[model samples]
Target: MKLDRTDRDIVAALQGGLPLVAAPYAQVAAELGMDEAALIDRLKAMKARGIIRRIAAAPNHYRLGMVANGMTVWDVDDAQVAELGALVGALPFVTHCYERPRALPDWPYNLFAMVHGSNRDEVEEKRARIADLLGGACRAHDILYSTRILKKTGLRLRRKG
Candidate 1:
């Protein structure tokens, strides 16, 4: 949808994410010289129009002592991938699980799962549990542990105009 001036302002404010305060919307409203009710209305409209996908907290797993994280890839039967992906995503240690198109010639993973824990052993244990759950449906899998984090932030909605 074509955004108006107010919509553009709201998008720009949200690009940085909601402030951590008792009344974050109000704080944003104050900063943008708009009222909280107006901000809420615009956000609602933006969501309805599919301009805003979701509002969520991007937690810092490392700071929370979840130091070990692994992106586990699996090659599963195409028919069972969706069901198993859902099951994997339900696991607490499995932070992310989704289906991806098979990687190219150099890469061969299909299904992707993210497991995180306080340490490497814990992450490995989680991987084992996921493997047991998948049974023979999973043909092959591997874990790629994270070595460094570059950047993490919320989406930027507004484009220079």
Candidate 2:
């Protein structure tokens, strides 16, 4: 999408993140010399145009004391994966979930959900809940734990010269 000067300014201001405050958008609007509603309208329009997918919090699980993180992969029946994945993703302990194509031959897991807790035991308990949710639809499953943290960030725009 071709972002105008104001839209470019908005993306630049938010690339780092919205300010940590009660009214983050309002603060950003003030910084950009625009009102809150106008900034929000621009954001909504961008989203509709496929310029932005979403605005959401990307919290640090480690800082939040959710040190144990496991991505549980399930070899689920293809017919029921989408419905089951949605249930698994909605679990309170589940950080994220999605369906992926099975690699076949060497790999077969097609559904994945990231479960988090303070320890492995808690993560296992959450996994059990997901297993129950999947029931007979799950053929096999495995969990892969994170070994190290990676920095996560949103889009970064280079300044026009």
lDDT of each: 0.87, 0.92
Off by over 4 Å in 1: 157-161
Clashes within 3 Å, all models in order: 0, 0
lDDT score for residue 148 of model 1: 72
TM-score versus the correct structure, for each prediction = 0.85, 0.95
For candidate 1, the lDDT comes to 0.87
The residue-by-residue lDDT of candidate 2 on 10-66, one tens digit each, is 989998898999999999999999999999999999999999898888888898999
RMSD vs true structure, all candidates:
2.4, 1.2
Who wins the lDDT comparison?
2
